[model samples]
Every structure is written in C-alpha cells, then in structure tokens.
Target: MREEENIIVGISIGDLNGIGSEVVLKMFEDPRMLEFCTPVIFASIKTMSFVKNHFKLETQLHSINALDQIAPNKLNVLNCWKENVSIQFGKEDLKIGEYAIKSLSEATAALKDKTIDVLVTAPINKHNIQSDTFKFPGHTDYLNQELEGNSLMFMVTDTLRVGLLTDHVPVKDVASHITEELITSKIETVYQSLIQDFKISKPKIAVLGINPHTGDNGVIGSEDDTVMRPALQKIKESGKLVFGPYAADSFFGSNNYKSFDAVIASYHDQGLIPFKTLSFGQGVNYTAGLNRVRTSPDHGTAYEIAGKGVADLGSFEEAVFTAITIFKNRTEYNTLTKNSLAVSKRKRFNPKN
Candidate 1:
C-alpha cells in the first residue's frame, strides 16, 4: 500500500442538492481510492451523513476540523460549513448555494496552503450559486480570481485535449471577448499548462478561427484575418509551436487534431462541440493556470439521474485520476529542473586540474 503522507487529495462537495454528494459517496466506497491518496472532503458531517444514509452506501466518514487531522484508510471530512439548514435531494435551493461556495472556498484555501496535493471538485449549478457574495459563473471563474494570471478551461480525453478561449459567454459577446490580447494570452496559458501540468514538453497548439473557412480571408469577417492571424504571428515569432487560424468547420473533419497536443477555440461552442462529439461522457474538465490543481467531470449535475444510483461514475473517476497524475508529474518535473540547474552550477564552478 502507498504511504498516506505521499498523496493527499482534497474534495469539494458541490451543490448539496445535486448528484455531487451521491458521486462522492459512491467514489469513497471504492477501497482503491485510499490506495492513491488520503481523500479529504470539505463538507459538513451532517451533509455527508445524509448522503451516506440516503444512498445506503457502506463508507466510513471521519470528521476533522482541520486538514492536518486527515488519516489514512478513513474518509476524512473537514467540516467547513455548519449543518444549520435542511437539504432536499434533487431540489435546487438558494440556501445550499452558500454552503456549496463555502466548501469550495475552504478547499481552495487548503490547496493554496499546500495542505492538499490535488483537488477533485464535484459539479456545481451556476444558476443557484450566482449571487452577491459568489458572483462568479462557476468554478473556473472563481479559481481565476483566486490565482494570479489568466486561466483557461480545458476539456480532456485520453486522445484529445481542447481548450476554450472564451467560456460561459453568450454567442453575441464571444466576438467582443476574443480580442488579440485575450486570444494570445489564452493560447499561451494553454500551451504552458499542457507542458507543465500534462508533461507535454514542446507542446503543439492549434488555434481555431472564429469564422467559417477562416473568415474566407476577410470576406465573412475580419476578426480571423485581422485579430487571430496577428496573434498567431506574434506567438510564432516567440518560437512557440503554435499554428493556425484554421477554419473551425474543417479542423476536426480531417482528424488533424491528433497531431497537436491541444486545440484552442475562439468560443465555448466552437471548442466543446467537437470535444463532446469525441469525448462525450468520458472527458474531464480542468481549470488551468491556478496555483492548485482542480479538475471535475466534464458533464453537469445530471439532475434527472441525481439519486438513481445509475449516474455513470466514469467521468468522476477520470477527473480524480487526472488530478493525481498531474500532481505527481508536476512534482517530478520540478525536482528534475532543480537537479539539472544544480548540476550546471557545479560544472561551471569546478576548477580544471
């Protein structure tokens, strides 16, 4: 068995009304989850108890006030929210939104403090959670605000990875959001994330144009030729392996995406359409450029199947595994870089006999 000290995974219980609790309960029932890391859930003990009893799952829950109290072979619960209210399964309630946000905030804080290695977040409802206190669209936006620099949402499968230049924005506003600076920054972030987190050194990134046939060379729209092309040129000059302004229509038809490490699309649909067509229920949604690792199942809350006990756990499983893999890879890469630099320094200072 792997030592518990090496792996510590923090989990955020998403909306108490959604399938988040059910999935978390089901996941912890798997004895193998302890083999990879000590799982710590940031939620109230009462909330988790309701879930375990409602689902009739055979999992043990240990309540702890702080992350340092996490123990191996036991499902640790870091009670961040008080169980002052009632939770109705499969029902949307504004009251639970605050609790959901609290769990996420506490989990993120722990991650920032390095108390946890990776974060596996459950699904959250954007409509219920958006309020005066928590105005962000979703976890991606919240994470962006919590970390320095920009962050992009990337959906990943075993064979394909797609990054969104603009997410959770209306189609009318997508063009306005796709400015030269935003496009360039998002692409750079995606490239860097693929290399650093996914371990794809010298990553090849493809940029998808905003219009059909790449704006037909300025006939359909000048955004592709004037804005996107200019950004691509600048990126290319920086010696980064970036290509395109390729027409969004034909880019995925020829299966050209396989040649690159990731694809950056101009809007949410432009990237997600092809990604969902290929990845469907098996993809993992990862928020890149945050100080801590965060990943969630690509699919939504699945309200219809919330308590049916039939919701596919594949995506949830994949999300947790992806977080673990990235955490380990990042650790190894940092060690290698430090060792290489030390060796170079020693070689430069050594005197010849």
Candidate 2:
C-alpha cells in the first residue's frame, strides 16, 4: 500500500462543454485538499488552462505527459490529448463527448494497472458520450467491465447510504431485470461494501419494494412477494442482518432509513430520487463491489450553470474525500484478512513452532 499522502487519485474530466471542469477546479482551489491525496487530471493542460481562465480561478496546474511525472501537493494535469478543443458552455457537442471518454478510459486503465490508487470522475453527459468504443449506459457500466466485481451503484453521504438493485434501466424493464440471482448478488455486494469500504462490522440493510407498499400484499404487484421477499428470506437465513422490501413512499419521509446501515432501492429513481432529496444534492455516487475505488458527484453536468462560476462544489469535494477514505479502508481490510488467513494456516501446520 502507498503512503496516505502519496495515494494518487486519478480524475476524469467529463463533458468539456459542461460544468465538469468548473467543479473540479473549484474543489482543488483550497491548498488543504492536496494534503489529503494527490490529484492527477487525465486531460490536457491547454483545455484546463482555458477553463481556469474562464472561471478566473487562482488554482495553479502542473502539466505532465506520464503517470511517473505526477507531482505531489499540486494539481497535475496529464495531457491525454493535445489538439485544441473548442469550448462552449451549456452546449451539447458530440466532439466534446469523445474527449470525455478519452479521459475516462485513460483513468480507468491507470486504476487497473495500479498506477492510480483511486479514481474520482467528473460528471459526463450520457446521451452525447455514445460511440463505437463506449456503449455503456454510464460510468458504473463501463467500470463494471474494465474492473472486477459485481459493481453496484452505491450513492452515499455521511449519514445516509443507498444502493440500487437496478441502475440505468428503464421503468418498463426494471422488473424484468430484477431476478432472484440479481437480488441476491446486489444485496451481497452492498453488505460486503459496507464492511470493506465503510468499515461497518454488522451492516444493517433495508430493501425498497418494487411496487408501492411492497405491492400491497400482491394487490398492486406480485413480483415483490414472489421474487424479492423470497430472496431476502434466503439471505436472512444465512445470518446476514438484511431486511425490507419496505414501502418506498413513506420511508424517507418518516426518517425510517436512519435505522439501517444502507438502503437498497428496487431501481434507480426509487433510490436516487430520495437520496438526492434527503441528501440535499450533496451525495457522492460510489461504484461499490469493484476491485478498485471510484466515486463521482451525484449531480449531472449542470449545463445551465456551466461556466457561470457558481457551481456548488460540495459534492465533488465529498467525492474526493470519500474516494481517499474508502481506498484506505479497503487497503486495511484486505491486509488484515490476509494476515488472519496466514496466522490460521501457521497454527494448523505447527501449533507450537
């Protein structure tokens, strides 16, 4: 494991025409952030320089061509591409989308090779980012393939944490996608993530029902009782502290989510709508159950506020902080587990040696 100060965080600059660059630069404006982890922006210095000038930010940037050239205590911008990119705030340009993919793919590769300890991606436009190379719905889908593990979309804040059973799937297709296997896999992923990423010992989890009032006892829908309930029952029998298939409507309004370590919503809006509302738009979207740690601000490109220099950076900063903390937690967890296994083997082989 790398030293705490030396933990390199790779940043993917998403959607040049949007506010991705603005929030990223704004978050690193404070010199104190450099003390937490080194940031390496996988984008060109020229483009970042233009954005910095437009935003009139005082944060200085260091340019590098390779990962080895990264300097600590400074905002390092890796030149992923050198060609000049025309910037127009609040406009959707397909050309800019390609650059977003470039930055993301490079950062992801670095993560896989251990060149970067963790990754904090800026928000990208889902519609414009489509191409022959990148065909996934969002970051979670792309990273699910690039990295290892089950890959659950886990939205987190200090007090409340929510994971989606099905992410980026349409409402019509959500139920068909939710099977016993998927329910079991996603729940297990959230449980293990709470332990490995957040350092929770006995994680309590609650699952939101697919239909309203958990299908009103099969009146509204039978999938909840037939599929979700049976899956949760099977998991509970294995001794995990998992519960629910609870009513989504009143859960957050009544503050019932406060009881559990994490909540699993049946679909995207079911989870994110309440999460964004309850969290006050300050949550971090963490890609959990993966071999590497990756997080992004819960908000989107915010094109309306692009280049206006009033973009709220609380979520972006929190994403960076969360990524660093999770990386450390996962590192410590893995080390301890390996040591315990080694000790057990030694005891078995030679009890008194």
**Top candidate when judged by TM-score against the true structure:** 2
RMSD of each: 2.2, 0.8
**Residue lDDT tens for model 2, 73-110:** 99999999999999999999999999999999999999
Question: Which 10 consecutive residues of model 1 have the lowest summed lDDT?
Answer: 1-10
Q: Which window of 10 residues has the lowest lDDT sum in candidate 2?
A: 1-10
Pairs that collide in candidate 1 are: none
**Candidate 1: RMSD over Cα atoms?**
2.2
- Point to the candidate with the largest lDDT: 2
Residue 3, candidate 2: C-alpha displacement in angstroms: 1.4
In Å, residue 117's CA in model 1 sits off its true spot by: 1.4
Score candidate 2 by TM-score against the native.
0.99
CA lDDT of 300 in candidate 2? Answer: 93
